[model samples]
Target: MNGESAMPPLPEIGDLAARQLVEGTLAPIVVLDADLCHLYVNPAWGKVSGLPASAFLGRTLGEVLPDLQRPDDVLRDVLRDGQPREATISGTTGVCSPLGQRLWRAVYHRVELPGQGTCLCGIGVEISSLRRYLDDLETAHQRLALLDAAATRVGTTLDIETTCQELVDLLAPSLTDLAAVAIVEEEFTGAPPPPPGFLRLRKTRGVAPPGMEWLLRQLGGPGPYVDVPRGIATRHCLDTGRPWLGNLASDELFQKVTVDPERTRLFRAAGVHSLLIAPLITPSRPVGVILLGRAGASQPFNDDDLVTIQALADRAALSIDSARRYSYEHTMALELQRALLSEPRTPHPAVEVAARYLPSGRSVLVGGDWYDSIPLPDSHTLLVMGDVMGHGFQAAVAMSQYRSLLRTIAASGAGVDKILGEFDRQVAQLGLDRLATCLLAVMDPGAGTCTAASAGHLPPARVRPDSDVEVLWLPAGPPIGTGLGGYESLTVRMDPGTTLLLYTDGLVERRDTDIDTSVQALETLSLPADGPLDDMLDTLLARLANGAYEDDVAILAARQRDAHD
Candidate 1:
């Protein structure tokens, strides 16, 4: 006792001090016995749990608050193990004012009371507002990411149907349970219409119930048109250029949007709980509408969802409009090309003739490729094949001018060389800046001879009655409109049962093969010895033009008959 200094006895706390400290502190404090029966609770506990002290005292934790039973079990474990623990629990309060839900961080400890034996003490701090703020921030980031992805995925090409499909795929299974795109029929025809016009279902991406599936199939995959009747929510949205959000709680609401009774029944049977209809609008007018729906298992669409979907629809509208304009222009260009290249004149009865024209498939613009046959005065025929250097309206116009001038000069009885010279001079004098390749042949069946000329064009191929194929060797000249003015002609003997083929480069040229290889391939091509001229031409095109080409093609075939026949 003398060697070891005794520690000073700890000072005892009064009941008044302990009571003041527990009641004045802001943190929620509660005391429960080992049996999970609440012995005491501070005022702060009442403020957070929305319960008074009277409600908590002298009652088992499960009997007073059922939602907190899980957290109370943790305190019971602490009492048994004599070890303290800390955890966060989330639950709704009994008396809700403005806070709908709450989270709490509670620290549980086993303590020994002066008169009540062993007990569990819990102190909790509220963290609901901070948790809510974080959740909101996360949702904002997700919306931003979705918008960015939509911008990248939509409008990859100038194809209306493809763009519509892309938009539908993006919204389904991510934003809604079902997604569909409907476009105006007038929009496809390139016609302007008043508001609330008919819409055609273009594409869909989701599975519906049996009833809704039957209705969708009846509307046609991409054909049938449905009118947006007055008083319907979709029509109102289109007329006002706004989005419509509704809860499909009753058949009456579904019937208001759908004109057919069967459709109304089908929609209600599908168990759709929420609907969003957004108008596909541009600065000029509304093009169509996009419909999205959620079934019973999914959450209803809110204001945020409506705003996001409307923005997506706006982007898709601009893409579709651009594609429609391109389609209109393509149709016009095709018609113009067809009108310019009328059927070739029937050559003399002694010669059999056939021709074909094929435009490039990679783009909408038409190219400058033409073929013609003019009957000369002396039982002869003049065959012409040419290709302009570029595509589009300008190339087509240049092609027409070249063909017209060539016919005018040839009709005056000009020879092959003179015709090429005159056409070159006229093209330069007229200030036509485009370049072209041309091959001209004058067949004189009466004289048993043929005269041919080249202007940077490929040589013609000849097939004899014995199935012998050969490419005529001639001096190549510069392309027309170059103003160089150097052209030449070759004369070859024409025999009975001999066929000649003249074509543009597109027939033989390919991106993966060289020009020389393609020319050789064409020169060695086999043809039936006794086939008709039309049959031979069809066979050649079918064999060569099996896939998409980078340029336009024009081919003319002429066959000479026996004198006796």
Candidate 2:
């Protein structure tokens, strides 16, 4: 903006002194004529370029370093305007470095010598190493971002197939053009690796661009893929516990393993040029393989990519193993509950018994809650519902013991209050530590009445034939195993066709809400009184729970039929 110089120009120096100073500096200096052809070069230029000064003199950059990009226009502008240009960056090729190239940041200015007119002088220094370090930092940042995504994206559900799907969804189009996760069939997580011949894999999920769909189809689609023996790429990943990267065109092991005709044709047709495979190994053993493929014009898989791919795969593998263990425990707990909850036996044709056990959609849903129907003396039917405190295998086992004891005690035709009092003493004597809530009622057909009692349990609802539903006023006692039994019973005469509903607290309890509020809410709802016993119970659950329950539910509904009907 100003015509005046920012500072005074350097004092004039002798020609010999200027030449010596230029030659002695480590920076490479070169002078070019107005035509941009090299006019002179210092000795430092020879050492930097690994060529004599004559190689640059009198020649254009195109003639000397044809592969390197030259900023000819910038130099011409400097020679015309007499202004200085500083820190112009460029890359040079065919240099004497190990990489056969170097990066340079240079300064250019217009200069006049005695015999020559105005020309451009450039002073440059190599910056290839610094540029490489910066590039490495950027690459590392991108890799960290990907790994961070894998933590949240993978294994949000505790299911084996779902975990497999999450892994492929995270990798495809990011690490490769195509990706798939194949789990070894029958190879449970945390188990030892199976023998090679028995290694058959089932592909759980494959992801790719829509255009690449045909490629996945041609490669036998999802499987039960053909059994891969020891030399195959997937087999290599399993055997070595390391990633395998290969080019389909020239990798010897890959070609030998995929010698079949259909695969060979598919790879060629799909333009799939490269592949990277990593084993999904948990701490115990290899569970599956991550298949990443690059097709058509995509860069081939390299070792640097292997590190990121394997890290993501490892994260997914650990989560999958955790899910598998949880599923196993859930199944075991549910099986134990099922064995204890066989169909309730109706004492006589006069009474109808309908029960439902709805476990919530979680691993803990298998624990605690249970119901049963037992026959008593004098053709009476005993209805029961209970929930052991806490959840899991231990709670399930405790519940089974409680249900078994109740069945044995009810056989003696004891009244509900006396039976519960006996239950408290027996469980306390048995050293059952977990508290349990229970409701027991006996429907006496001959007497036309239902008598019930509770042990820290919810009240039973009586749905009259006219649709008048009310939770009976049953006295409460400490939960079983409290050993402070002060039990009481309430009897209500039931008209024929009236239904009695018994349930566990899971049917109404919710977080942050008063238990009485939830119970009163249930009482306000209109029940399907005239419908079949099963339909009425279903309607009750649909209206009350509505898929929002976090705990298991056990409900039993009983109605006494008219003697003729």
Candidate 3:
């Protein structure tokens, strides 16, 4: 022991001046003996515990204040070893204060008095306010982190439903036990805003833990639209462009805000005690609202929580709006692509034709890929497949230009090589900004020969009646709009029922792998045996362009009448 003699002793307990010093101090002070029984306590202790000092003097710590949380073992050791110790302690001891809970940094020192044995003197400084400040600071940090997460994870696609699901997924299992996203439905549909009253909300997404989905859905989670009245929380969030939070179990505002009592009953039945409805609104317009809920005993949403959700909602709203616009444009592009590559008419009836156009999957921009079949007076059918190198609405418009130019030039009875030669000249003369790849095949059923030419495009495939597939290699000149023409034509004899498959590069050109490899893979495909040309096209797409293509695919399949059928 380091100089037990050097340690100062406490004054005699009966000394009036020593008692006055202890009583005058604001800090709670207590003295306990070797048996851990309170030998003395100050007036400050009485003020905090709401009891007289006499109540604790002769009592053990647990017997007098069992609710107080402290390091009991450390206190006992300090008394036993005559050493000093420090600990943090806190509790709500049924005493009223600003915060029902109280906290303290307590120091315990072993004091020895003359003739009297050693006792532990414990002094506690309240630190409840500082602890609360740090707690609030940490909560704020978490909220900003939540917002950053929402910004990164939401709006990952151009799909409206997908964006809604992203928001719901981010909210649930983090800020809420159950969550849903609703939309105004017509906000992106060009419909005018509805008049004030009850508004029908389209459920975009509803999510909860695996087993709780059904319960959430019963509370207007997802699927069929929910019609909300003027005073309803959802409507309040939407109309006012603000959040509406409530305690469904007891909040009187629920009754005051709702025109229908069934809404309140629905919440009660769903066992949702706390609910927060936040608006998903953009500067341009209000998109919709989101609902966050907590079940029994879960922490209710607070002002800080509400602020965090609103920030998340603002981000989600912008993402949803962007996705909606992209979706509309993507749909329009697909429709236009389909229309341009519509079913090729049966050229001269002696030739069968089937064409298909598939836009790049999940791409917001449209591509210019087209196919056509034109009958000439010389009893030949001109089959065309072309691709514009870039993607956007402008590319689709340029593709129409190329398609129309091919038909107009083919009507003059130009050869396959001449048609491409002229196509290049006009594209350059017209100053079309996009470069293009074109493949032209002229089929003569009487001669049983197919003359094909290419302008910087992949070669065509010939599937013989015996199921042998060959890649027809022709001289590929510069792409159109390059103004460099070195076109060449190759004629291959077609046996009866032979199919010439002309397609854009998207059908074969994949990401990462070599172009020649994808082309070689296409030549080895086993087409459906003894079926219509349409089935052959379907088989080709299924085998070659398995899933979403990185680019648009245009396919034109043609064959002269088979003799066996």
Cα RMSD, each candidate: 7.6, 6.8, 5.5
Q: On residues 1-565, what C-alpha lDDT tens digit does candidate 3 reach at each position? A: 1111112234564566776677778998887777778777777777788776667766886787787776889987887786789987788664788876789899999887565587788999999999999888988888788888887899987788999998998988788888888787664254444456658777788788666676555666343666667767677778789888786547465554344555566666556788788899999988888888888678888888888889999999999989878877777867776676566656977888887777778576678888889998767999888888788778888988888887898888988898889889998999999999999999999899999999988999999887778899899999988988879999999888789999888888877999878888866777864689889888888877566888877888888876554
Candidate 3 has which clashing residue pairs, if any? none
Whole-model Cα lDDT of every candidate shown, in order: 0.77, 0.79, 0.80
Candidate 2 local Cα displacement, residue 363, angstroms:
5.9
Worst 10 residues of 2 by lDDT: 1-10
Q: Report the C-alpha displacement of residue 442, candidate 1, in angstroms.
A: 6.8
What lDDT score is found at residue 264 in candidate 1?
A: 63
Tens-place lDDT digits, model 1, residues 166-245: 88878876788777777766544553443454444334333344445654554322334565667877778788999887
- TM-score, per-candidate, Cα-based: 0.75, 0.76, 0.82
RMSD of 3: 5.5
Worst 10 residues of 1 by lDDT: 1-10
State in Å the error of residue 318, model 2. 2.8
